[model samples]
Target: MSKIRGMRRYGFLASSIGVTCAAGLALVPGVLAGAAAAAAPAAPATTAGAAPATGPVTGPAAVPGSTQSLPLAPRAAGRTRGRAVGAALEQGLRRADVRHFSLVGVVWDNPATELHGSVQIRTRSAATGTWSDWQDVDTHNTDHGADPGTAERTGGHIRGATAPLWVGDSDGVDLRVRADTGDRTDDTAAEPPVPLPSGLRLELVDPGDTPGEDGPQTDQPRTGDLSEAATAASAANSGLAPLGATEIPALDRADTERELLDLRGDELTDAQRAEPHIGARPRIVTRRGWGADESLRSPGFVYTKKAKAAFVHHTATGNNYRCSQTPSVIRSIYRYHVKSMGWRDIGYNFLVDKCGTVYEGRAGGVAKAVLGAHTMGFNSNSVGIAVIGTYSRSKPSSAAVKAVARLAAWKLGLYGMNPRGKTYLKSGGGNLYGKGKNVHLNVISGHRDGFATDCPGRKLYAKLGTIRSTAARYQGR
Candidate 1:
């Protein structure tokens, strides 16, 4: 079977990041404020109306890595009144040229609110200056985030969002959001069209220039001494890589076992130390390699006691990126998740591109149990691995799936977890499980296995069993 839409194309220019919130549909420089301050509540908007279909929030020369947030308003096309559609209105942004952004998503106020509608975008390729056909953006992506009551979720800044689409470096975009009209239980009255969420804003993200392409390499990321925050982030991974190493090089099985013994230290018993069953460490591009603007994340790192399970996810940002431009896609998401969604950092622990290149996600060391906001209720004691594109209607590449298997085998093996086995993860409270519930789950589970929503998608989820078997083999089980 072929994908409903073949590999989508997304390219972007990373320059400067911007700030955005539910209340204020404005994009400011990411460097203008601290993460905490950036996440602070925004003053309420005095009025409710769509912003003019202006292109970028700023001028043509937007802050390098940029985000163009435009509010959506009702359009006259396809709208109906008089019970059949209940004053139904279509919200959209007419074709317009603005900034150089590669990724796009629609966001709205209220995390609990769902957009009962369709979101489609047609973009003009920045390189060719030709418009592509309209592409559907996943509307049910709220299921891919943090669970209820968590600080990340409870934070006043969080908002409901559609799955972002990676549309390559595009200077122009056209969007349409039409509400769904559900089947009526009875014919008594015409079913009113479902309402779109409040405060819908279209987000255009430019990942900015690739690190080495326009600036210093990751080994020496900047001209001057590194910032205190940047140093700390690098130092956290010092156990595995050099202080400023761009990547953690792959380690053979023997070295990996030695590394395991060294990393586990007092945690390992004499027997375990002698025969530390662990898989070889895969090469991982560090945050620096991907040009993560360290200051963009909240200060400090959060970690769980240890990783017990691995929850797989798809970024749902579409399949329109080449393996080479994956870094830009990640940087774009980093800015979007932090600056736009008001999170401390990007939500996943690790990101695997379609080509199987794994990038370190969330600042903490790759070996440590870095807490992630990826899976809502079951984040604790688990590692979140996000494959780079949407897998709902498409199949993940063989390399991507293999990378997940390799990552899970190594990470889970650190905590003595059996990839082919099962474990229990307490729900912080989610749609599927109640708080503190020790839910039995596979050592490697799809996001939807823990949450009720369709995550990791049906196609990707179907491969979980294969991934488990493969990982177990890698662990030499």
Candidate 2:
């Protein structure tokens, strides 16, 4: 799957689920937030007696990583190329010099609306002073979000967005987005170019400084008072590790069962208790280990009834980063999701760097059934694991694939699930299954299995059989 072929193959089914879309990124509280308050600036709290937005604003400005939202306007009518029918919502060759940023994406007013178009960007390297070729931003990204009709989906301020593209450290950029209004050329035709979604804004994300910048350790200690949300995130893993532990140590199979039985003994069946098939617990760096600004996400953790499946994904934020910068890259994506894309948190449940190091994602206990905003219609009752690179044409590193298996084996095992088996998950709405419908899926499936999009990418998707076999072996199946 060459990148070009991959882009050409990204066609959606006629009946994919859609949701309400809103624009802007203001900080709000409750089940889902920011929509009704998009007009407010991210910082300098004006919430009537609120204490001057001091530390780690989930609102953007208070954090080290920031998002620059530049509005997209209509291009001049005189432009000769890029009109599908008539001059639709086309941002033609807009260039700007801005603060340093490494990742970029485009967001629109409504989540239900699809940008049946093309998005391309080229950037001037901050270090090299040279321009890179135009890279296409994947348009088929609506599949990577919350299920339709959920509070997280309907939550105010949610917007339609393309996948964020990692461009490495760059200061100057050129952006262009054109809607595919079909191939009608006549200006007098009744149909117009399918206009791009409303409130379209180009978002450039600065992942911020290294973790050690403000502390002696890479797992920078939380600064200032912790938000109730951050506290809850830490408390979720109370029995697994000491309070405020930066990483959870791995345990052998026996110790893993002991810990699991200690934490959730009451729920295990007699058979499961007698013969636990759970794999050895793998070491996982916590959000704290990676210096996550916990306050950046809205103050709540949503969980499914029980986790039954693991959906694999690729960050699609590009492969320009090194393994050492994984934390920074994750932070940038976190900021982009919460502050830029208007979500409750970073979408994935866990993230794996190319070197196979796994990091906790979506601020919840690693062993819990934490709900994630990944896999769209299939988010409920499933875990999402995203490798930190685009894999359309590129082969996923062997280590990354193995990491997925190891994480899946232990996570699914917690619920007595067999990684190599099949499970039924009711559809929340997607091209493959409509809302409230039951659909059978492999216990370990790719993102595309739940929605019509090329995710986890082709190379990684192809490695699922291997991942499943490896995970099953780990569980002694």
Candidate 3:
């Protein structure tokens, strides 16, 4: 079957399963792996003798003008049987009826708490005025791992989540959800019933798409005071142009030659310099290269000292879009992260489109250890590379797979790590391992390896062996 056709088929299969098994057999942590839990990271230390904050968990307020959250009250909820527990949109959110919203996600309760639920949605397609089949939202999400000292964990409006599935240029939406009490302890009926997720919310996100309206203007060149000829080239190199107009500029041969002149000031460590040479860096479209509107983000990029491992993931936005729509898809995600989720920026360190195009994500330089919100409990010393589509049952394009290998080889070699070898990452705090526990993992691993989620999907996760070999070859291992 053609790629698009396969994606639609997957969508149909997902929806069918969702309708039939919405409550009974929803996604469990062990479905992907055999419940081999990683150690959760250690909790934050208190100040001197101060008591820990043990108050009720609160959700962050909705982003101003970009998103609105509507409550979803339970319908015929039954705790004992787990049969009558489901929630639907209080009022149907038809795209035709509500013309303003562009994206949707189910939000609830505390960021630190886990939510077990199945969500299915059907959207109207703009290409044909027909409504598409209901598709299952990726519910086994473990992307909430934030750095211990970072604002994202202790500060931001974090909450329980499902991957936000996009419905493009559509006019209608129907959504249903069933919350499962994920506890599987078998000590009889002595315990209090696991609280049905309180404050179940549906977030309607508006992308604010328009010419010169989606985001603030890109920053001007830092070399603005240079000669006009120099400044013009610098502006283009720095991604000062508007979004969508970016063409992923080629690396300047002269610039590369000059950088080669300095071996002492290189970002690579002394040990890495002594190791077998990996090939030169791969072509990367920087944040400036993709025309990211820097003014939309909080200033000053954060960085870790070195990246010891790379975690792979799928964006989990369905595979309905063409390659030409990649940039637009990225832009929408950017707006969603910053505007709707109240994140500082897009969560991944980099994004790979199906066409093999690599776009820089986050504000930090490509060579730096820019912390990302991709893997739960393991963000500190790692890099997250997300392919831009779902691959639960369908195969990923070869180009996308090749891109992962190339990017992994380059980034891992920078830290003197072998793409196919194992490395240790200290957990910040997660279901897998306790905080501060050093966990050994493959140098390049799927999101599921470190967190308890079926991310990067089954098909793509299975290809990690091939990806590892290809990357090792690239590193001259």
Off by over 4 Å in 2: 1-63, 77-89, 181-192, 212-228
**For every candidate, C-alpha RMSD to the true structure in Å:** 12.8, 11.7, 15.9
Overlapping backbone residue pairs in candidate 3 total: 15
Report the lDDT tens digits of candidate 3 across residue range 1-477.
Answer: 011111111100010100111111111223211211111112222322222222212222122225556666545433434333333312123334645454667766665555555677786655576887888877654455465445665554656666777666665666766655345545354343345455666666554442123322223312212332222222222221222222333233222222222211244444433444343455665553344445455433445556789999998887877675565566667666665455666889889988887887875445556667788788777899999989988889999999999888766755667888999888877777888999999999999898777789999999999999998887667
- Determine the backbone clash count of candidate 1: 17
Q: Candidate 1 residues 1-477, lDDT tens each?
A: 111121112111011011122211112224323432443223211111212211112212122487788888777654332224433446888656688888988999887888987899999988999999989998887776666665557657788888778898899999988887655544375565668888888998988885634322444323134455665566556446555567777878766775665455446666566566567889898887787877777765655667899999988888878887888889999888877777778999999999899999998678776778888888778889999998878999999999999999899888888999999888988888999899999999999989888889888999999999999988888
Model 3: weakest 10-residue lDDT segment is: 10-19
Write the residue-wise lDDT of candidate 2 on 312-429 in tens digits.
9999988877887788888888888888777888999999989998888987568777778899788888899999999998999999988889999898887888999999998988
Q: Which stretches of candidate 3 lie over 4 Å from their true place?
A: 1-70, 73-82, 85-95, 100-102, 126-128, 181-196, 206-276, 288-296
For all candidates, what are the clash counts? Answer: 17, 4, 15
lDDT of 2: 0.74
The lDDT per prediction is 0.73, 0.74, 0.58
Listed in order, each prediction's TM-score against the native is 0.83, 0.82, 0.70
lDDT pick, better of 1 and 3:
1
Candidate 1: where are CA atoms >4 Å away?
1-63, 77-88, 183-191, 212-225
Candidate 1 lDDT: 0.73
